[model samples]
Target: MAATNNQDLESKIATEVGHADVYDEKAAISDFKADAIEAENAEHNMTVLQAVRAYPMASFWAFVMSCTIIMESYDVFLMGNFVALPAFRNKFGVPYPGHKDYIIETKWQQALQVSGQLGALIGVFLAGPLTSRIGYRWATLTGLMLLNIFIFSMYYAESLPVMFVSQLLEGVPWGIFIANAPAYCSEIVPIQLRAPCTQMLQMFWAIGSIIVNGVAYNYNSLDSDIAYKVPIALQWMFPTPLMVLIFLAPESPWWLTRKGRFEDAAKAVERLGRKSAVNSTETVSMMRRVIDMEKSVKKPNHLELFKGTDLRRTLIVCGVYAAQNLTGNLIANQAVYFFQQAGVDNELAFALGLITSALQMVFVMLSWILTTYYGRRDIYLWGSFANFVLLIALGIAGSTGTNNAASLAQASLGLIVSVLFTLGPAPASWVIIGETSAIRLRPLTTGMGRATYYIVEIPCIFLASYMLNPTGGNLGGKCGYVWGGTAFICLAVAWWGLPEMKDRSYREIDIMFKRKIPAREWKKTEIDVNDDE
Candidate 1:
């Protein structure tokens, strides 16, 4: 039955793509026969720089797929900014005793914010089954179409309940998108392009955030409610183009292979690699060998995520994501609230937020350049440490000093923190987790990690909101102390557990874990996957 399915797929793909020799060239094998494959075919893959010079279309499509994260970024920035808008507040909350502006009650605010995360948690668990069944391209398209409905709801919302439900529904697409997009992006590129391309998720996130902050800074102060609606309407711009482009994009090659569609997988590789049929055939063969080895060793199940070497990989992936939330980024999200608490005027606060997003954009670009030379572990280790020290400075400057200098210092530190966090943990966290999983378990492990991340993230979001709210905890900069301590712990974990996966292939990563190589030695130890195969 499987052989018949393979032949049917081969005929269809060859007819459509003109790659007719796919099946006749080599018989698919379940076992890893190292000697049968050439060293050049199995390893010695293109570097990030070389891949782009060779295949510009591959990079272009990668940038297109990363639009999923851009949508995720725009939504998060828009929601955080919405609470700071005068019109949104006036519509949702009671007016203050002496002031004209209104604010949501602390508890209701927290509930509204965390509801999206809860929805995301549900989406993360669902992504594995849906993406596996429908394939990556369709799953992403489905999520984007659903997200458009929810975005319009927020634009038209007149009451708190409607907006709350809208935010919750919005998060469903976000969870599914976040769960699957990174894996898809990583799979579509070569090993050299893998980390840099996946890191585009974070870069585009900062781009979306900058766009929202730029728009909100200009429109947030209008007397009418259209100020907020215009920004909410901007959400439409992202999905429309993404939907059109995604329709034209190919399904993940790795995903096609998983479903016993080898001919289709080869065509995808040919498209992505811009190579001849022979090279694409060899690439598909190599991936099939790795995937076969993985499934034969253990059943691909959710329970397996918590078993053996995978347990460690899963834990590290989850920890990296959780560390992203805990490292004072929660305060960055509450930029307007923090500025209001520090006695900065509303306009200046919005300007600072704009500048913060811009600086994050700069640092994310810097991260791309740095990753070319550095490993993921040391970058995370140093970035977290610097972030902790900055947090302490921000906390002291914010809590004790009441003058202009102190306020300026606090804001300065906040901007610097944003830059360092972007350079260190922000992009690296997503890249590390996306690269760490086996192809068969990529969706399940990445989803579980993100779900765990949101589990830790929900409380941090609420706490950051409460601490900065004038009617709530009002911790001001003092909230930094709590998160700073958390950053220190994350730093230690990175130093101890995270491995160097720079330029490493999925097959190499699998072999390293199987051999029980210590995390610190991953860089020094050479595992020739081609020779071992």
Candidate 2:
């Protein structure tokens, strides 16, 4: 009787548990699917985060490479201060007129500037082929060589024509260096920190400008010929040390992968990652993915920039960069003259040049901090908005015909606006350029962007001469119009065209147009690869 009861109870319990097992299994399947999706998402997030974390190290070396290039920007702008001084023009037999009219306002000076741009035009075209053939490392070295040769030659260049030729040759390297540096920085830096790293280079360029300005200011006061010659000759100093250092620096692993040198590329990636001699499966996998992607896509030409999805992006890049050049900053390469027009003494003008350069560095640092913490869009928008307000204030101040305290206040406001100009769009423009384009298209896109920059700058520089000419009507008001017009355009572009790329991965940005995500929704939108599949 006991065994019969036990068997009956066991049978009942088994029947109940059998139904429970079916329910449990169904639940488990659902959980497993959800978990798989979560795991993939987590894995993707980790991959992107890792890339972000790895950016600083890679960008540090690239920053060092950039120092070499920034020296060129220094040389370009330093002329503004030096040309205003008696030392440079007098020694070189170039005439130095009063403040509103100086050697820089002359036909020869205009030619020199134009020649540099002409060389840049050619150099931009040459950079792709040269970099493609010799690799970025050697291409940079070639640029350094050209820069050094020109710098050393500038010391002995007796006539305007000779100086023009030297400046023209200098543009080749300048174009090559600027063109390739962005791609180099972009390739080596992780996507998350790409904006900051590239912007850091711009900051350094500003720092270079400061250093050159300060040095030129000091040399300007000196009576010796060596004052100008020494500073100009020092141009060779940065490149040699940079070349030696970069000789040990790892070449871009992406470039290596492009050339089909997988083993060498692997080694470079290892060095970039600061890993031991062991093989990196992750690096290899990324390399393979990149190579495969390159193989699958059709390469775009310059004309393609105006058609298809690329057209919108190209236009924005062009507009932003053009605005950057047109905003009177590069034109402010003639800052010394502007100061003199403001009735500042020559010594004070040089002093102010140094101060302005230093202040720009400070603002750029603030910009970097804001960029890292605040969103790119906010900084860009606020920058333009503030600039617009300041420009309007300047216009009002100029219109009042007041040279008293009110005039000084307006001038101060203008300087502040210029500082904001540096802090805001100047650095932001490059970051946007780096972030928006695909890696394969970076060179062409940056080339076009820079081409727009120079093209716009050439005309602006010429126009500035006409507007600020003492003989012209109401020079201050005319200059105000230029600034005011630029400020308005920047405001409009920031409002409508500029995309918010902050915290978004390059892959996400790559899908921006394809998915047609609005700029405001960029950060909040989750890119769904499965939908395309």
**Which candidate number has the best lDDT?**
1
lDDT of 1 by residue, 405-476 (tens): 877777777778876788988888878988998788888888888898789989988888888887778777
Q: Count clashing residue pairs in model 1.
A: 1
**Candidate 2 ranges beyond 4 A from true positions:** 1-56, 91-105, 276-279, 287-300, 402-407, 471-474, 529-533
Count of clashing residue pairs in every prediction: 1, 0
How close to the true structure is residue 110 of candidate 1, measured as C-alpha lDDT?
80
TM-score of each: 0.91, 0.83
* lDDT of model 2, residue 170: 79
lDDT of 1 at 182: 85
